[model samples]
Target: MRAYERLLNYVKIHTASADDAECVPSTERQFDLARPLCDELKALGLTAEVDEHCYVRGWLPATPGREDAPCVAFIAHVDTVPDFPGEGVKPRVIENYDGGDLPLGESGRVLTVKAFPHLPKLARRTLIVSDGTTLLGADDKAGVAEVMTLLEELNEKKIPHGKVAVCFTPDEEVGRGTAFFDVLRLGADFGYTIDGGFEGEVVCENFNAAAATVSVEGFNVHPGEATGIMKNAALIAAEFAAALPADETPATTGGRKGFYHLTDLSGNVETATLRYILRDHDAGKLEEKKATFERLVASCNEKYGAGTVKVEIRDQYRNMKEKIDETPFVVDLALEATRECGVTPICDPIRGGTDGATLTRMGLPCPNLGTGGFGFHGPYEHITVEGMDAVVRILHAIVRRVSEMKK
Candidate 1:
């Protein structure tokens, strides 16, 4: 079966991750995908296991002469982001796409060349999209299918590849994918995550990220007798929101730029809570962004009462480039593979975190590769048949090249 067909099949399973869940996988539904993946790997004559954490792992033994070559890995996430509807994704295929505005489902939604002009390059190829009611889940499902199909190709063609390790992680959308992952068990010298966007794009650097929670304690009193004694927590929450630099936000930031995003807000007069996520590729800049929040919280406390507000900032993940620098060939291998497939490689810093980032920090020397998806995490998400085919070639080239490389 084609990779796109595999993608459409996997997306039918509802694997949307829950936010702030205490468990490793976040939701048991993630196992819906994990279990099947392990079974498939086992059927392919590989040792596969599905642990309690919902991580699907499989090993493809090295070819006879390739035993001394370094072991490599391919990683992808199972859970879709809860930020959008991930259930019952009806993948609409636009075959032989013409270079013009293509109408999606009802509601007058159209995928136009103006907004996504890069689409012209995908003309005459099959485009997999949603029906305008839900996200297509191509964010990582495309990655999953591409990796799966590559393994099948390697086995059928009897390709001489080194020891190949594969992992399907859960809850990456909630930033806890690697929370229970066992890098020692994975046993790969290095790996590449196929969860990136666009063909030939490689991601080695990702944001130094943090999640913050700000709480406001209000002193409530009767309106008639509330003179100088009542403080509205909701108003303080609004004030806190207003105080941050309006220019520094996800909406305002782009390539290599950092931002503070307000994710959730709740509460009223008695107590109020505001949640914000911070991101920056540079460590110093990330610290500055965190300090900026601390400064803002201090100012709010000073402007209000002393004990009126409290803030907690927790580090999420750091840039993988620092770790990738230790062994640069892992990235160079991907670039070499892209060229081998006749695609120009575009190396860029990740705008968000990935499972690779966590694995890199855990000593796997992981980087990221593209899944040829764009406008992810929303109904606008899409991937092309040509794109999927290209990535498969890329992965195949990377593996075969790695097997031939001298450690």
Candidate 2:
């Protein structure tokens, strides 16, 4: 089957991961997609298995004379983001797009050319989009379908290629996709993550990410007698948020700029909580951002009481550029494959992190390849059938190139 057709089938499963769940996969629903993917890999004659943690791993041996070629791994994630409605996804296929404002279902949300200027460039292409109420799950599912289709093409066409490994990871949206990953077991010299946006985009750098949580403790008293005794935690939480640099936020920053994103906030008179994600391409700059959070918590504690406010911070992942730069050939191979597919490659730093970033740090030296997807993690998400076909062609090129390599 075609890659877009497989994407249509996979997005129907509710695979949104939980951010607060303490489990490895984060949610049980992730297995709903993982099991089917494992079965499909097995059907393709690859040795495949889904572990208890929901990681689907598959291996395909090289064809006859190509046994000496390097084993190349292709990776993608199964879980969608929890920030939006990922369940009940009803995809709408627009065969040969018109490059105009397209209405999505009856949800009154239009995918406008003004909001997404790239739409005009995609004229006459087959576009698949969501129904305006939920995310299209194209962020990484498009990658999954493209990889699956690549495997099918390799088998059917008798393509000459090296050993190939494919894995579908879970909970990537929640930043724990690689927590239980076994790099040595899959046994690849290097890998590429099919989790990037748009066609011909290759990501060698990503953000140095960290998550922070601020807790506020307040004393509650009756309103009539609360003037001197009551301390409002909710109000203090708001004050802390207001003190943050308005310009340094997700809405205000782009490109190589760093930002502090307030993801969740809830509070009452007695207790309050604020969750934030800090991101920067430079490790030193990311450290500065974390220190800013610490300073704010200290200032709040001084005014509200010594123990009224507290902050906890944890590092998520670092920029993969440092690690990827160590082995430059991995990125060059992807760029060469894209050009061979008749597409100009766009090498940019990802504003967000991917499983590739973590896997690269784990001595895998993996970079990211595009899935022909755009406007990820929200209702505006979309992909093109032609674009997916291009990615599959690129994957085929990569496999052939690997087969030709010496050792």
Candidate 3:
């Protein structure tokens, strides 16, 4: 099957990971993609395994004389974001896209150039998308299919390559993809996540990320007895949310700007809770953002009563660029590979995290490459035939160059 066909097939498998599973892979259904991918890798003549953690790992041994070459990896996550509709993902391919407002299947929602603005760049390319009822699952499914295609082509053309490793991880959308990843077992010197971004965009730096939960405890009283004697927990929770600057939010922020995103909220007159995600490229600023939220909570406690508001903040991931800067060779090599495929690489800092953020901190030094998929985590997600094909060409070039470098 072609790469796009593989994408359409795998997306229909319902691999949306759970956010509250508390397990390694976060969801049992992720195995839907993991097991088959493992078997397919073996079918492609590579040594592959599906560990208990729901990670699919495969290894292609180096050519006879390139034993000294370093092992490189291509990583992709299997789970679609849980925030969107994922089941029965029906993909439609618009061949020779005319660069206009492409209508998604009868949803009255149009993929407009005015909204996305980047839509025109995909003119004449085969744009692939869902029927508007569900997400296309192209966020990382595109990455998965591309890697599989690369392996298939390498075996078909008898390309001489080094110890090339491929890993399809689960629960990356829920931030646990690499938690149980056996980096030493995969044995990659460095790697790339074909996860996000527009075409030609290479993401090296990402947000210093954290998740925070704020809880408010309020005294409840009967309507007749409630004047000032009652403190509504929901009102206190809203106050805590309002304490953070509205300007410093995901909707208001853009390139390199930090934001405090309120992901969820739930509460009643007696108790309420708020869940937020903090993001910033600068580590120092990221901490400041978290600290600012804490201060707001403290002020709310002072008003409501001590211990009335409680806050718990946890680190999710850090900027991968810190480690990548120490090992620039991998980034340079990938850039050269992109050039070889006749595309210029655009280095852009990701506003969010990837599996690379976790792996790089684990000493793997992984960066992110574009999968030609855009509008992630929602029904607006789409990819193009020509765009995915370009990335495959770039992968082929990288392997050939790495093999040649061994000599």
Q: Which candidate is the best by lDDT?
A: 2
**Cα lDDT computed for each candidate against the true fold:** 0.90, 0.93, 0.88
Tell how far residue 70 is off in model 2, in angstroms: 1.9
In model 1, how large is the Cα lDDT of residue 279?
A: 92
**Model 1 weakest lDDT span, ten residues long:** 99-108
How much is 97 displaced in model 2, in angstroms? 1.5
How displaced is residue 128 in candidate 3, in Å?
1.8
Clashing pairs in 1: none
Q: Candidate 2 at residue 51, lDDT? A: 97
Q: Which scores greater on TM-score, model 1 or model 3? A: 1
TM-score of each: 0.91, 0.89, 0.90
- Our tally of clashes for model 2 stands at 0
Error of 1 at 236 (Å): 3.9
Task: Write model 3 residue lDDT over 223-317, tens digit each, in one string.
Answer: 79998799999999988888789899999999999999999999999999999999999999999988897788778877878999999999988
Show the colliding residue pairs in model 2: none
lDDT of 2 by residue, 1-407 (tens): 99999999999999999999999899999999999999999999799999999999999989989988999999999999999999999999999899889999999999999999999999999999999999999978999999999999999989888899999999899888999989999899999999998779899999999999999999999989998889999999999999999999989999999999999999999999999999999999999999999899989988878989899999988999988999999999999999999999999888988789889999898999999999999999999999999999999989999998867
Give the lDDT of residue 281 in candidate 1.
93
